[model samples]
Target: MIPYEEIKVPVAGGELAAVRWPAGDPDAPVVVALHGITANALSWGPVARLLAGRVTLVAPDLRGRAGSSGLPGPYGIAAHADDIAALTEALGLDRVVLAGHSMGAFVAVVAAVRHPERFGPLLLVDGGIGFPAPTHLSPDELMTAVIGPAMDRLSMTFADRAAYRAFWQAHPAFAGAWSDEVDAYIQRDLTGGEPAMHSTCRIEAVRTDGIGLFDEEVLSAVRKLPVEATLLWAARGLMDEEQGLYDEKRLAAADLDGTRLEPVAVRDVNHYTVLTGDRGGREIADRLVAYARA
Candidate 1:
């Protein structure tokens, strides 16, 4: 079985929760895993387990989610990056690999660029590099497009935790990905009971924190950092033709100039399963281990 221990590090004015998966030594190369929006550190379990005794793995729940909930802030990418940096300082960690998944990847990129001395390398699982920033849309239109239907889960109060969980299962993103392992992970972050299940995530906090507010700043700084990095994106989900992260022309034009960027595409994974599903996580873990060793 994978071995881990609970760890709490102070960040800003509140404490953030993390799971520390120890390697053979304290001085070993450390890797900090940052989860996405609506997800906590546990989401990295499969990947962390695969690393085993090779490298130390520290996964944080991030502010406004899980044990880090209720921290006051804008919760934007910059804030998340700050909180992460704070956590590192609080724990007295230095020169570690920072790997972030999904939204967390966005934060990781910003953090590595903003605080180059704190991280050795950067690994972005599905999202880290610069992308198109909306120029024609207002804030309201942006929120609507960004949140889409997931906003309902944030705005509505569930009768009980069960109902919320059931609602999540109905989401197209997770239609066929739920299994006993997935269910257990989901159950850990839910509240209420009986007729409904509500997510422990603070919706307003997420909306405010989840938006990408530092695209230009991050992009400008990306070329300055000497951090080795790679991005492993799913073949489907946000990149699918129906709702891609970019238009074909835009995607082709976007590049990580002056930075070492490697791309890996998982054949059949989507946004959600790319981190949670067995095959997807396993593939990521393999890459992470190889990257860390190199």
Candidate 2:
């Protein structure tokens, strides 16, 4: 695994705990990565390792999750977008290849729209395109249906770090794709002592952000992006189901206009493995390196 360092980034409410993988060269291209709603910076570990010093990667634990869980929120996609903008400024990054996975893809869209000058090419993994909100279901039900186990874990406690690892080990998506990088990512989300440990993700934050996924601003934010974006979608669902998040029919329905946003299908991976597995991580890292170099 490539070496990385932990750092703190000043954002709106408080400092955002982050991880940085240096590229050694001062002039190396930089990629600012964003994790999913209930995920932390360590989720990018696999991709970082695959990059192999090609580009510097900075991934942050957005407010209300993991190391930044203590930070107050006003949490949602838009709020996270603002914090991302702040992160670039704090680090003196005038332009960066902005990449996001899952919910982070939503945040990337809003951030690019809000601060176009700060971003270059956008790499959206397994998310960013908007899904039609169901009207029959209430907000809570909708969240449970969409977020599934990720949201459910927020309210559950584990006996220890080992227990937390076991929970993720059993997830269908991670069954055959588990690795040391995946384990580290899982362990980073744990908080509190043994017998009472739980995910650092805040329920309120997940609820608000899950709701924001369907917001008009978020749904339409992609249309307003200043730069081109490449969306990498998994072939399987979150639970390793046959149908993944974005298929040709779904992408066609979204009406991307085939100009600014390009959707590419990644086979044999799920939402989680698309960032954690070797195949998916290599694909994503290659694109990031190419874009950053461009």
- Most accurate candidate by lDDT: 2
TM-score of each predicted structure versus truth:
0.86, 0.98
Q: What is the lDDT of candidate 2?
A: 0.91
lDDT of each: 0.72, 0.91
Error of 2 at 30 (Å): 0.8
Error of 2 at 220 (Å): 0.4
Write model 1 residue lDDT over 1-294, tens digit each, in one string.
366898888777778888888988766667789987777888787777667677888888787777677666667888888888988888787877788887788888788877877877787887765654478877656656655665555556677656656866887777777765566556656765654556778876777654554356655555565687877777667323244343335444765555676666676777777887777888877767776676
After TM-score superposition, the amount by which residue 191's alpha carbon in candidate 1 deviates from its true location, in angstroms, is: 3.1
Query: Model 2 misses residue 240 by how many Å?
Result: 0.5
- Range of the 10 consecutive residues with the lowest summed lDDT in candidate 1: 238-247
